[model samples]
Target: MVVKLKLEELKLASVVFHHLWTRRNGLIFQDVFQSPSTVTTMAQVDHVMYKEVLTKDSERTARRQTNEFSQSWKPPAWPFYKVNFDVAFDQASGRMGIGVVIGDSEGELMECLIAPKKHVPSVFQAESYALHRVMELCIELGLSQVCFEGDAKVVIDAVNSKEEDSSWYGQKIEDLQQIMAGYPEWKIVFVHRTANVSAHTATKLAIRVSSENVWLEDDPVEVRRSIMDDLVCNVLNQS
Candidate 1:
């Protein structure tokens, strides 16, 4: 018996059958015989089956694209003499801290973090706040080429990809993007937590300080001192 199938339906059915056969399962002739009406008249099932197949194909295509994009994506490299900044925030104490370590292709040049009191709720929020603070610091330092590093993946991805604009912090993300746009050269990077230790310490200290007090320094003496003391204590205990 000849069946008249829609062009789209025939293509979809061929695709579906190819996939099914690849799994080592042959089509059941008995099933087709049982559904004689459907098998003999493509009009009986073509429209519904075509839509279902189309949707499945579309979803598969989208997933493949997402995977490809992720695998190929890489952060831009820092330029020579670029100003690099690391920022951290404390949500509990509502304090934001930024540790900027400027360097060139040569080596480390300068470093600083500001402990400013502000109300923040979560680590993610603190990360974003730190980024905003870094931009301000960059402008203040009169540096046009700057790179920012943060431990928070969410914030970095939001700022770099421009995908977070539809989220809760969408407005803030857009604002930061605009601010960064003013600079001829600006880059944001996601770094390992270990590399961000100084900024993390600065953020903790910043939260401890009162709102009236804002700690600004080129060198983070207090944080360095605390680390030294911890190391010394550990050595003494081992002895």
Candidate 2:
């Protein structure tokens, strides 16, 4: 019959049983036998190693769970600002729509911009241009400590990398790197689409607006709602 056991007790019993099986195999296959004391010592060593493996597995599981719960927008640390950028494209018109959102440590909107660019060669160029626009705006606004975020993993990775990019958009990435070098405290990060709702919404808005749209401490209704939803998700996840 089977019975439930406390974690430690079960682990000890499993290790002991495993080593006992190994000892039996040695007797049959190799015609070798060890004393009871020797077998017990081997089992004890297996138990210690098994416990260490279990501990590491438990730690990895915990870290993964934490990351899953934190899949929403979060405020930056004190004295720092967070910027999120995104892009949308119209194939028919060959125009790329760009959106950028900036927020303070309190999650309060500082500024936002939605602009349309025409004759962009590719989506990669569009994403890269959006990041470049962010750098210019941050510098113009005099934001010294800023954390730039985007849903474009490729663009973010290229910006963070030290190696030279030789792709079609390599020159743009190089220009961005040179500009970013002047501000040592600024950084760019990649986030999931769900966590970048506000900026993504602004990109959708860019499709309708004829000229560039800028908001100071406020945003369009759709973008504002998205930001509020992020705040709500952040609070729920924390609680």
Candidate 3:
């Protein structure tokens, strides 16, 4: 009977069998397998498995998915930065807040923005405006490569689609697409609320202020803790 074993299971089974054989007889795998070449093949399989899935990086990824700190801002690739935006809406006061924070590949804060919008009717409107600020900043800074992220699925879906625009913010969305068309390396994505805490903090701060604010290099002390927490998370993932 031929026993078909999966590649992973075969490697595991061979490794276990070899370990036991070496210990029991005080001899190497060559004597147990009766094939000198088998030792090299098993060692190669172990090495490949270690590099592919059994390494420290892979283990950390699994832990991150299940851990409480799973919601984290992922760093962009080199030469590209990530912009995370969020909106705060206050229907009672007829005001909206747009927060945009940019981070580099090393998880350092590159830029921060707080734009307080009036006449903003709904959450969707606020989110769309936040998207607008994010792109406008990217263009002004001559950042051609960027990753725009937000927690609002409605805004992300509408912006990323090439479909006909008809929403209340459709016109502005079209305008954003045109501005972003100049930068082929830019993209918009939606992330979990947890991963969007930094931008949310900025939005909350905007509610207390009356004017548009921009931080080119240093983030305000109010949002520093969240940024520090995010940087710490990134560092832990590397280990």
Among the numbered candidates, top lDDT falls to: 2
Model 3 per-residue lDDT tens digits across residues 1-239: 99999987786667656534543443452343324444444344344534543454665677678774555777899989999988888855559888888988887888999888885434555666778777878888888889988877766786788897554356767877787788899988878666788999999988888999988778888777888888778778878
Candidate 2 residue-wise lDDT, 183-225, digit = tens: 9999988886767889999999886777898999989998899
lDDT, candidate 1, 115-225, per-residue tens? 564644344556677677777767877767666665566667877884644444667778888898887587777764444454566665555555423333344576556
Worst 10 residues of 1 by lDDT: 68-77
Model 3 lDDT on a 0 to 1 scale: 0.74
Best by TM-score: 2
How close is every model to the real structure, measured as TM-score?
Answer: 0.51, 0.70, 0.68
Off by over 4 Å in 1: 1-98, 211-218, 222-239
Write the number of the candidate with greater TM-score, choosing between 2 and 3.
2
lDDT of 3 at 221: 86
| Top-down lDDT ranking | 2, 3, 1
- Considering only N, C-alpha and C atoms within 3 Å, which residue pairs clash in candidate 3? none
On the 0 to 100 scale, the lDDT of residue 126 in model 2 is 74
Clashes of 1: 0
